[model samples]
Target: MQDFVAGARSAFLRLASHSASDSARSLWADPSGVRGVLRHRLAGPTSAIAFCVLLGAAALGVGNAAVFLGLAGFVAAQVLIARVLQHLGHRLRPDVGFRVVVVTWPIALGALGAAGWTAVNDYHGEVVSLIGLITAGLVALVEPTGFAIVWAVVAAAAVTTGAAVGGSVTGEALVSTGAIAVGAAFGERLRHVIEAFLGNRRELLEETARIPASRDPFQTAERLLQPLVRWTPVKNPSLVWFTPDGRSVFLAVAGNNLPPHLAAGRELPEARNAYMRRQAEQGPWTSGWTVVDGDEGYTRGVASLGIQAGAYVPLVHEGRLLGLLTAGWSAAGGDHSAMAEYIPALVEVAHAAATALGPGLAELEQRSTASQVVDDVLHGQRYWPVYQPIRRLRDSTLVGFEALTRFDAPVTTQRLFIQAGLVGRLRDLEIATMRAAVMEARHLPEDCWLSANASPGLLVDTDLLASILEPIRQPVIIELSEHEVITDYKPIAAALGRLGPRRSLAVDDAGAGFASLRHILEVRPAHVKLDLGLVQGVATDLTRTALVAGFVRFAHDAEFELVAEGIETQEDLDALTRLGVGLGQGYLLGRPERASAAASNENAPRGGRAMGASRVRSRTARTRSQAGAIAASRTTTPAH
Candidate 1:
């Protein structure tokens, strides 16, 4: 099966990183691990010399040629083991070299011990037993869990050879075996503790230091620094964010270890350009912790604190420097030069943090351009309102008109509202638009009602709304769109009550969902408008027909008028009329137009209704070719 091959291929690829043999070797044969343990043992340079002098002067030090020769050979084997561990590459194969050396080491020690005991039988073979005990300790320190496995072969060869040659179950062999068993018992527990600690550390890094999907950049930076300072040698970590102008660096957050002298969350006077120029000239500078050592900026940064050294990791993504993540340490904490092996992991963490803040930083550059355009539009007052006629389905005569905002510029109503909200100017822009619409109400025929869309939040302003509509002779109906929700309308109901006959509320988009249904019941608006999503295909789509039928029944029971919005087709209009809807508005009834053009439509002849509907149908048929691309591109509205 194709699935089986794909799985096998994936497993083959993973073998490079997760081989059992390599896992064992990395634990036992790591060059640095070997060096650190050997440095404290008799095999090391200083200690080896001391050990040789002491062995020569011991009570059983009477020189035997075979044992002396064997000691030279044994020392040679130890040197070879260290050298091979230090220089092992892929071809030198850690598993192969480790197997050969561990086996050869115990054999050489066993042979030397047996030969020396045969020659003298003095000193009770204590020196050989002591070597076995210490060798077991060295294994426990470096390999931990693997000590028991390796010592099995060692005990068999050493004890069997010593007994077969001359000694008869000497007390020395028992001491050596007991020492090894004790170290191995404790070594396994120590290894498990270390493994548990490492697993937790890795999980924390993955959770806190990965590139977030989207978030507040400073919050992400603060999360990243917590564990960096906790687990790593990072003593005092500070994450900085740049101003839009990039002239200053503001510390967003810092770890608890931050020095008392430098209070965080303030802008630093140091010019970022200078540090950047130095990095450009020097190229890819990392002091293992990702900073250039001895740079002038670094020295100045740590001057007041007790920190003697530091790192300045530039958080960059997609060629933009979001900020800098800096960490430092006092002299007593130790140098960062020993962190060379961990540099790759540190760089990975930096990249992830940088990516989290990158998109938010990109938005900053665009804000200036966008804000400027929005300001020009606001100050220029380039937006105006157009009127669309709403007719009674029974008489085919105009009853009201809705005021829709129109812009001379290229922008969608949805995008306009969204951009205004993002810029924190929606309320102001909406107020300005509403004022323009209210001013046009006086021009409407005295017999007709003026309906204008507004958000639910604006319902709280009874006095302001009444004053804005005071100039109009026509009754004003305020309709809140379906896009917004009203949790409780008690305050809104009270506000409208104060205005009395001057204003009445309408719930826009009744049949869409729960928000509109709740608005219908709570506000008890003068009329409820069915959304185009439910009305557009009611003639053909059974689901929409069922939904509109239910809404009609509810409106009839509540004794409130129902207006169907977006009646684009004759089929749609006929469906609403048959369903007992009293009102309808859309392209089919009349296209939105200025007040002068709107006057001719208000009290039209009964014949004009059929003619206007026919013309709308013809225009729709004609423009389907030109507008098809746009209509197709918009995401499905509803009934998805």
Candidate 2:
């Protein structure tokens, strides 16, 4: 019950903020709306004053009996005092002019005693009347809805006392005054109750009316932006996409049509800040693309005087240039600097458009470019994988050949296909490379293995990883580049999860950039490659020597097998051997070549490992011509 009352009161308060006095349909009309209003307006002071006047008349009309006269006068005087106080306070009575009236029987009776009435006869009756009024007032105040009830009790006591002793003018007035006061209090309470109910009903209607406008964005935007557009003048605007070479490629105009310069083949100023920012940043760049009207002199044939003035923000995603956002002054009277004001809003729209497009935009672009290349140059002119042997360092015998991918006709460059954010797509290209290498290796010694560098994104796709690995029967190690940012490792772990336990995971660079030794621990790779920078001068530099030694210790504890890469000379091999590195790969061993021809020199002696090497070796074995293979083969080892 209390919760219900509190909820009702809260609803009332919420409605009251707009207008508390207005009339409407009753939400809470328990006492009945009309009755509630009447109770509120005339109930309190009216009832109290009327009761006092009636009681006074009754006291006078009676035969001047001392007891009746005294009791009636006392009651009248108390009511009079209460009425006067209520008027002075000027507060809204819930029912009557005065919401509450306190009739103190003890005080009234004591006054009667001073006026010559005594407990010896009328004194006991006077005492009872005084107690009754006191109890009645307290009860009515607590449960205000029962004010009329308690007032009746007080009135009944007065009339009964008057009738019991003797009929007189004083007795009649007491009865009349008591009845009037009870009615007035109930009336005032009723009026307030009606008013509260009506106020709540009106508010509920207003909120329900606004429900539809919030859901429609176009409607919402119109309603929200109308004030800004009217006060300023610019409304919905155009956005443009840029090519990799910073040319305007596409345009999406939301409201107004685009200027001629924004169309394709339009030249943009290289002196602008937007051009400069993109030029300076090799990855992604952004700045405000600004333009003014002809007042700033024939506005690049794109703007007439006071016609177009807006800002465009460059949008580059995943290191590939995406586009620009354009918004302008809705008003015609703005200066060229108005372009500056539109920058923030333009940037916001740029971000929204970029996020909506998703990550495939860059990959789609690169695929388009790759398709263009293939269509123009044919498949034979494209990239091909060259196999380099990873032989046993101790025996100078071949263990496996690491497949290295390189482009043939691009001629100017021969690197991995990851620059256009297409590393994931390269997994398909990697699988193609592996298929060719394995099919070629079928003619070689039966025990020979193959190690190939695969794109890291492939590790997250289990099915893709399976397809890539399924064709190769020999032991295959997929080397991941350390240069790429690996935001998530779980996918890599999951991909490797489906592979054979003998399959190896190798991190190409052991200690460099953000790819610290921690990556080794995180991925728990089977093998780690010492970067060429670290391996180049390990024999000469003590610092490099110490660094490698420390890494070797960590590898041993973690159970990771280490490979010192880029060993160009016997001295490099000798240094790695002393440092307890078992395997080495570099120019001094054998340059990357075609798989079949590269394997023909399997038994030949070399400065490093011989082709087709397979004997396993401990960290202590370094020089070629030992019994075991140079590449360590372990079921599983600790992460680097």
Which candidate number maximizes TM-score?
1
Q: Model 1's lDDT to the true fold?
A: 0.58
Writing each residue's lDDT as its tens digit, candidate 2 over 380-457 gives 535455666665566556666677644433312222343223333444455555556556656555576666666666
Question: RMSD per prediction, one decimal?
Answer: 9.7, 21.4
Q: Tell me the tens digit of each residue's lDDT in model 1 across 350-373.
A: 677777777765665456445655
lDDT of each: 0.58, 0.49
Clash number for each model: 0, 66
**Cα deviation of 52, candidate 2, in Å:** 84
Model 2: residues with Cα > 4 Å off, grouped in runs: 1-250, 254-381, 409-416, 422-424, 484-497, 513-516, 608-640
By summed lDDT, the worst window of 10 consecutive residues in model 1 runs over 631-640
TM-score per candidate, in order? 0.62, 0.42
